[model samples]
Target chain A: MSINLNRFNRVNRKKIFNRIERTHKTAIPQAPKRPPLLHPQLDISALTDIFLSKFSASSSTYQSIDCISLVPQLVLQYTELHNTNKTLVTNLQSLLTLDKSPLDWPDALTLSTPPATGEQALGLSYATTAIAETGSLVLCASKQNPTTVNFLTDHHIIILREQDIVPNIESMWKQLSLSAEHMPRAVNIITGPSRTADIEQTIQLGAHGPRSLHLLLLAGD
Target chain B: MVEHYKSNPQGSASNSTSGPHQTLFFKAQSSHALLDNTLQEALKKAKGGFIEKRSKAIADVENFESYKQQAQLVKNHTLDHLAYYLTQFEDNLIKNGGQVHWASTPEQLNNIILHICERRDAKSVIKGKSMISEEANLNAALEAAGIDVTETDLGEYIIQLAKEPPSHIIVPAIHKTRQQVEALFRNAHDLGDRELDTIAALVDEARLQLRQKFLNADIGITGANMLIADTGSAMLVTNEGNGDLTATLPKAHIVTASIEKVVPDLESASAILRVLARSATGQPITSYTSLLSGPRGIEDLDGPEEFHVILLDNQRSQMLGTPFEEMLKCIKCGACLNHCPIYSAVGGHAYGWVYPGPMGSVLTPLMTGLKQSSDLPNASTFCGRCEEVCPMGIPLPELLRQLRNKEHEEHLTPRKTRISLQSFMWTIQHPKIFYWLTQITRKVLTNTTLSQFFAKYIFTSWYNSKELPKNNSKGTFMEQYKKSSKQKKT
Candidate 1:
C-alpha cells in the first residue's frame, strides 16, 4: 500500500529522523561500561555443571543428559580477545560427521556449525541465563562466531555465562544495547526446542528444526 | 452446528449435568479420563514439524530479531495507551465513511451483530477464523437468529462441520487425524465410497465446498489482528488469502475485534507483522497480510460496498488500569500455547473456553468470571515456558498466581484444601508440636509396611506415575545443616 508521507509534519518528521540517526551512531556502548561480564573465562565444562544443577532443582520429571556428547563438535575458542572474522567452515564439515555418529540422543539437542556462506562461525556467545520472564537468551549475537553457530546447526547449543543472567525481559534489552556496533543478523531467544502441538494436539518436537535444546552454564569461570 | 452434536447428548452429558459455574467439576472428572487417552495418543503422534518449519523460515531472515523486538515494543506501546487508541480508531473509522459499534459484553456483541444482519436482510454470512467470534459464540447466536454462517478457514471449516470448537489455535483441526477427518467428511458431506486418503484431497474438497459460500454470502465477517488508529485500517494476517476474499466479495464487511488491537501506524504494524508470522506458523510472512481501510475506494475495482467494525470491549476495557493490562499486548500468535506444557497435555478443548493454553487460562477467568473458572489458573505446572516464549513479554505465571490469590480471597478454593492448609499453618506456628508431629509421621513412614499402605491409599496421585523420594528418616535438612555448622566451628 502507498502511504501518504506528506500527511506527517516536516518538523516532526525531521525530529524522528534525527532520533533514528542519533540511535544508530551511539547504540553500542563499550563492554566495561555495560553490565560486567559475570564469568569472563566461562568454558564448556563449567557450563555443563551449572546446567545440571539448575535442571535438577526445577523438576523431578526431567532427566539429565550429556550436552557435549550431543554437539557435532566442541569448538573451544582459546582466544583472549573477541574475534569477529574467524571462519570455522573446515572444522564444521569434520564435526558434522562426528555429530551423526551418536546412537542414543537426548530429547533435546544443540549444535554449532559454520554459516552457509563462508562467513565466520558465530561461536557460542554466553548469556548469563535464559530469562525466566520471557524465555530469551541474552547473547551478543553480533560476534560473528556465535551468529553463524546458532543458525547452521540443526540443534542449537547455548552456553550461558553465570554472571550474565538477568532476572527479566527489560534487562535483556539493556544488555543488547550495550554493544551496538555489530548487531548480529539475528538474536534468537529460544525457550524450548522448536515444537508444535498442531497435529491432534500431539506435540512433536523437532518437526522442521532441532528437536532438542541443551543449555550449559560455566560458573566460577 | 454444535447443536447437531448436542442431539446425542452423551458426548455433552458431562456439560449437561452442570451449569456454567459447575462445569469445572464435570470437566475435571470427564477431562481427567479423557486426558489420559488424549495425552497418550498425542505422545505417539507428536513430532515437531510446525515449529521446525517456522525456525527454518526465521533462520533465513537476517533482521528477524529486530523485527520481533520492534513488534513486541509496538504491541506494548499500543496496549499501554489502548483506551486512547480505541477512541482514535473508532473516530477515524467513522470519519472514513464506516460505522463503529461498541460492545461491552459478548451478549451485546451478539445483539449488535445480529441487528446488523437483520437490517441488511442477510441470510448467509461467510466467516474467517476469528477467536473473538468463537469467544462471543457468534456463529451460534447468528444461527439461533436463523442466519446460516459458514466458517471458511480450512481447519475451522472441518471443525464447524463436526460441530465442535477448535482444539488448537493455528491448526484448528489438529486433534483430528486424517482417518478421523475422513470419517467426519464422509458423514457430513455425503462422500460415499470416495477414497480421500491424502490431506491435499481433503483440502481441495473443502475449497470446492466453501467457494460457493464465498460468492453467495450477503456479508463477510472476520477478526482483525490489529486496527491502525492513525489510518482507520483493520489488518488481517493469514497464511491463506481467505480473509481478503471474505472481506471483499460480500456487499458488507463486518470486523469483530477486541479493543487491544489498535496500533498507531503502519511502521508498528510492519514490526508486529515480522514476529506474527515467524512465531505463529514459522513463516517469514503469511501468504496474505491484508489491511483494509474502510470500504472500497472510488477507483477500487472489487471490495465491500459497506464496511463496519464492531470493537468489542467484553471486559477488556476493565483491564486497562489493572495489572491484567499486559494481557492486552498479546497479538494472538499462539507461541505461548505451543510452548505450554499444560496446553500440550490436556489440549485446548479441556480448558472449556474459546481461548486455550496459558494465555487462555489467564484470560478465560478474567473474561468469563473467576468464579466460573477457579481451576484454570491452578492447572499450570508453572514451568515458566509460556512467559519465556511470549513475544509480547506477558508475565503469565505472575498473572496466574495473582488469579490464584484472587480465587483464595473469594473462597473459591475447595473447603477441604483450605482446611488442610489451615491445619498445616497451625502446626508450623507451634514449633514443638510440629516437631513432635513430624517425628511421629517419620516413625510411621519408616515402617515399610505402613509406608506402602499409605502410598496405596493416601498419595495415589504421586504413586500413579512416580515414586516418593526416599525420606530423610533421621531428621530434616535444617538439622543436617546445623550439624555441619557445628563441625565447621569445631
Candidate 2:
C-alpha cells in the first residue's frame, strides 16, 4: 500500500511545526543572513590539471587518449597488464564514438549485455560529467550505461570530456536540473574506486566494487 | 526481547535479538566493558587512529570554521523551516516517480518495509549500514518475516556474521580484532582447507561472498547521509561502495533516512560534505557518494525499477525547539565517540543503545525515558571533550546535565543522593556555619596522626575500588591566605 501522506502530515504537523512556531518568533537568535554567492570564474582548461592530480592523489589513475580508434588497444593493454581475460564495456553509448572512432573493436571488449556474473575483470563506462572541486566523475545511469557496470567489475574505467567537467558540485546540480525533466534514476558521484578501512581502520581498496579506477580524459571541447 | 533465531545452513548467523543495545543499566555494563581485556585492546588500537586522522584532516583545511559554520547554518535554518523543506522534498520526490513514506515510530518503519518486500515477493534483501535501521530493529523484523537480509558493509557484515551490534557508527565491527574475525570466518565460512590468516584474506573472502548476494538480491535497503530537498535525491557517502551496489543492483532501492537529514539545496549538501569525510575517516572524499532519486528511468538499462524513501522520526521531533535541538545537526561522524575518554575506556556496547558516547548519553535518556537510562548521563566524567571535538558543535555535557536535572526532578535517582544534595544545599546557605564546620573538620581530618584511620573508617565502600587522597598536613587555604596577608602587612 502507498503511504497515507495526509495522515502522515496531519500527525507530524502539530509535533514538528508547532515546535518551530514557538522557536521562530522567540529569543533564540538566528544566523545573520549573508548575500548569495557568485562563485568566481576560473580558466576551465586549467581544471584538467586540478582534476587529474587530485584524482591521482586518491589512488585513481588517469590518462589522455587522442581518439576512440585507440580504445581497443588500450583495453587490450590494460587486460594484458592485469593478466585478465575480458573487459566489460558499456553500450559504447558515449559521444566519444561520435568523433570518427571505428564501429568495431577488440575481441576482448565484451558488452555487459546479460548483466555481469563477475567473469569480467575490467569495466569501461561513459561518464556524463566530472567535478573539478572534488575531482569526481558523475554518471547518470540509463539503459546504455547501466549502474551495475560501475560497481560489479574489478577495475572501473571512465571516458570523460574536458568540457563536461564542472567547477564545483553546485554547478553540477545546475547541469542536472537543466535535464531535470529526464532525470536519471541514479546519479553516482564517484570520487575514486571502492575502498574500506573497516578492519583495524586501515584503508584497503577494492572492497566490494572496483579495486582501481582509470579515467581516459578526452582533452577537447 | 533477547530471543535467539535458529541457525540455518546458509551460514548467515541467526541473530540473537536485534542487537545488544543495553538502554538501561549503563553503570554495570560499562563496568563490565571497562574490565574486558579484549574490548580495551581493540580500543587501544582504534583510539589513536580516529583522533589523529581527524585532527590531520581538520588541519589540512585553511579555514575549517567556514565549513563548520556553513553546515551549522544549513542545519539550523532547515530545522527552523523543516516543514517547508520536507514538503518540498516530498513533492519533488513524488514528481520524479518516487514515493515518500513517513514513520512516526520504528514499528511503522518496519511495517512499511515489510509491506514493500512482501508485495514484491522479495526472498532476499541486501542492506547497507543504517543506524536508524538498527534503532528500528529492522533486521530482526525482516528476518522474522523470513526475508534473507545481508549486510554489505565490511564492518557491518562482520558484526552480522558474529550476530553482534555495531560498536562504532562508521566502523560497526570496531570492537573486533583480526584474530576474532579469523575465528569467526573459520567457524562460518566453509572455505574447506583455505588458510585465512590476514585481514586482507578475510576482506577478499567477504567480497567474494557479498558479490554473489549483491547480484542475486531482490531488493536493496540503505541509509541516507543526507536528503536533498531540491532534487529529491537521497545522498549516501560510503568508502566501500556497497551502498552504491546495493542501490544499483536490486529491482527496488529503499532509502531509510531520519527526518532531520533533509537539506534545502545542493550547495548546503556540499558544505556538509567537505567536513563529513574528513571528520569521519580523514579522507578528502569517500569513494562513492551516490545521489539516487527515483528508480530506473524508462530508458535506463539497469537499476532498480522502484524507489522508496522512508523518513523516520523516532523521538527526534520531541527534540525540536528544545535545548537538545542542536543535537539533530550531528552527522554521525563519530568524532565525539573517538575523542570521548569514557567511550575510549568502556566502548560502545556498554552504553547499551544504538548510539554510544556523549551523544548517546543524551539520546538514550531522552529517546527511551530518562528514568530507565538515568545512569547513562551519570557515566560521563563531563570532561567536555565531546563538545570540543563535535563537528556540529553540540553542547554534549550541557545536554547530559539536562538529563541529570530531569532525573533529580523526577526523583529517579536514589533517595540517598537527594538527601545528600539537600544537605549540601542547606549547608551552603548558612555561610558562617559552613565555614566553622569546614574549618573544624579540616583541622580534625588534617590531623596527621588519626587521619588515615578516620578516612579508612568513613569511606570504606569507596576505598574498596580507589585509594583516598593523601591527607594534607597544611591547614585550609583560607587560614593560610589570612596568615600570608598579615605577614605581608608587616
Candidate 3:
C-alpha cells in the first residue's frame, strides 16, 4: 500500500517549490517608492472638517466638536460608545502596552505575536477606510511600528481621512496596487471584532479578537 | 424478565417491512424515551453561543455579504455541472497516484472501506470528524470486523466515548454538559486524579489521549470539505489541526466524501472557505486549512504514504438530474443546524439516523427508503429558517414540501389517515354536509363531558404538551355569512 516516495522525489519537490516561488515573486510588483511620512505642516483643521462632512453622509451618529480641544475627549467617548463590553477596554489596554505577559493574549493573537509593552504603542499607526470586497485593510504599520499595535489592542481606533474613502473593494485593490512594494506582508480587513458563538449561539463579542471598532471621521475644521 | 424478553405480536417484526407510520410510531416512542433527558439539555444549551459569535465575525468584515454571495455562486456553479467535475476529480486523483472507489449505497461504502483496511492489514484506524462516515455507519462495520477505530476530533472523540452518534455536525457533543463529559471521561479513560472540571482541562486530556492514537494508527480516515478537481487535492478545514495530523501521520489516508464535493479550482475553494468557517464556527479562517495532495513526496518530511479516496455516491448521484439536486451543494458546515428550531430542540440523534437538522430531514428518506422513513420529511414546521441561513441558498423548506407531496402521492401515508383525509375532503366539497357535520361535532363536544375524556385519551400525542382549545359552541362562520348575504339581497 506504500507509495514510492523516491520515484517522485526530485520532480515533485521542484514543482512544489517552483510554484511557491513563482507565487511569492509575482505577489508584489515594483512601484514608485515613497518615504513613510505623514504630510507635515498640512492644514489639519481643514482636513478634519472634510472628514466630518463625509462621516455625516455615511453615519448620522456624529456630533459637532472643536477639533483641537475635543480630539482626545472624542476618542475616549467613541471608544466607550462603540464597545459594549467593559472587559474589551481592559483587554485592549493590556494588549496595546509593551511588556505584558504573553499568556494574557488569546491563542489566535498569540499565534501572530508575543504580548506588547507600553513603549510599543507609541509606534502604532491607523487608517480608517478599507474596501469592503477584497478584505484589504488600510494600515500604516512600519518598522518602528510593532505589528501588535494594530492587532493586539482590544479597542482599535481607526481615524479615516475623509478623502481616502473609496467607492468599493475594487477601488481599494487599485489603491493597494499603487504601493511601491505592491503588496504588504499582511492586510487584515476587519469588519468586526473577535467573536465566537460556539458557546451555544450566544454571540459573546470579543472572544479572541478586537471586541470593538471605532471610526473617528474628522469633519471640517 | 418476561416483559423484557417477550416480543409483542403488535410490535413490528424485525424482518417484516412495515409502512412508515408504524415504524415512525415505534421509533418515535423509543427515541423519545431514550432522548428525553439528552434532548432537553441540548435544546437549553444550543442557542446564544454560536449565534452571537457568527454575528461578531461577520461584523468584523465589511464585505461579509459579498464573500457569502461569492461562496454561494461558487457552490452553485460546482453543483450545476457536478457530473463533469466529479469525473475530473476522479481522473486527477488517479493521476496523482491515488485510488478512488465509488459506492452507490452505504453498505457498498462500508465494504469498500473495510476492504481497504483489510488489504493494508490495518489494526487501528484514526478518524477525523466525518459526517459521511456517520451516514454510512462505517465505524460500527469496522468494529464488527474486529478493527479498532478512534475518533480524533475533540467533539467526535467525546461522542464516541459515550457510544452515541454526533448530536451536532460541527460540535458533535453539543448536547453533552460538562458534568456528563466528566462522567464519560472518568468511565472511559484513566485520568487518575486530574481535575476535569474546566473546559480547558477536558480538552487537554482528550488532546493528550488522542495524540498517541494518531501517532500509532495504521490508517487515517477523514472527510473532505472540498475536493479540488484541477489541482488533485483534498481540502480539509479544521480549527484544532487534528485533521492535518490524521491525514498525515498514518501510513494510509482514506477520504470518504460525497460526489458533490468537487470544486473547479483553488479560487473557488477559497471562496467557499470564506463562508464555511464564518457560518460554522464564526472564524475568519480556521486554524488549519490543509490541502492534501497524493501522499508524501520523497522530499516531504511528514505525510501519509498511501492515499485512497472512497467517493460514496450513496444516492447523491441519483439526486443529480432530479429536483433534489440543490441538496448536493451542501458543504456540511452545520449552519442550518445552528439555526434550525427542531434540531435545536431534539438534537441530531433523535432523528434516529445519521445526518440531522434540516439537511437530514430531506436526506434521510432519500438515502434510506422513503417507505421506511416517511415521517422525517413531514416532521418539519416549514419555517424556512434553514433555507434562509443556508450558505448555498438551498430551498430546504420547498424541497421538504416536495418530498411530502411525493410521500402522499405514493400512498406511503397510513391507510386510516388517508381514508380520514379523503372523507374530510368529500365533506368539504359538499358544504351542506360539511356544515352539518361540523355543527354536530361541535354540539356533541360542547354538550358531553365524555367527549373531552375521549379526546384526551384518543389523541394523546396532540394533547401531551398542550391543552385542548375550548369547543366552539357558535354556529359556523359560512352559515352566518350566508344569512348576511340574504339580508343584503332583500
Number of the predicted model whose TM-score against the real structure is largest: 2
lDDT of 2 by residue, B1-490 (tens): 2111111211212123335546677778877887799888888999889889888888876667777777787888888777677777888898888888877667677878988898899999999999989978789999989999999999999999898888888898999888888888788778998878877788898998898899899999999999988788889999898998899888999999998999887778877887798888887678888888787776777778899998877667667767877788989999889888888988988888788888888876666666557888887889999988877888999888877777776688888888999999999999888888878878766676565666578766566556655657466767788889999999
Where is model 2 chain B poorest over a 10-residue stretch in terms of lDDT? B1-10
Better of 2 and 3 by DockQ: 2
Per-residue lDDT for B488 in model 1? 100
Question: What are the per-model C-alpha RMSD values against the true structure?
Answer: 18.5, 6.3, 13.6
- How well does candidate 3 reproduce the true complex, by DockQ? 0.04
What value does the lDDT take at residue A202 in candidate 1?
A: 40
Q: What overall lDDT, based on C-alpha atoms, would model 3 receive against the true structure?
A: 0.60
Q: What residue runs in model 1 are displaced by over 4 Å at the alpha carbon?
A: A1-221, B1-23, B26-39, B43-68, B437-448, B461-466, B470-475, B482-490
User: Compared with the true structure, what per-residue lDDT tens digits does model 3 show for residues B375-485?
Assistant: 778667899888877878889998888777777877888897799999988989998888888777676677657567766788777666657567654656676788889
C-alpha RMSD in Å of predicted model 2 compared with the true structure:
6.3
- Give the DockQ-based CAPRI class for model 1: incorrect
Q: Score the docking of each candidate (DockQ).
A: 0.04, 0.45, 0.04
TM-score of chain B of 1: 0.88
**Leading candidate by lDDT:** 2
User: What tens-digit string does per-residue lDDT give for candidate 2 at A1-221?
Assistant: 46655576467554544544554564333333422433324457688787777688788888798666666677768777777767565666343444654445666566556255567787877788888877899987776667878888888888888878888777887777723345678788898889888888778889998988888877785
Candidate 2 wrong stretches, greater than 4 Å: A1-46, A93-98, A108-114, A178-181, B1-21, B430-473
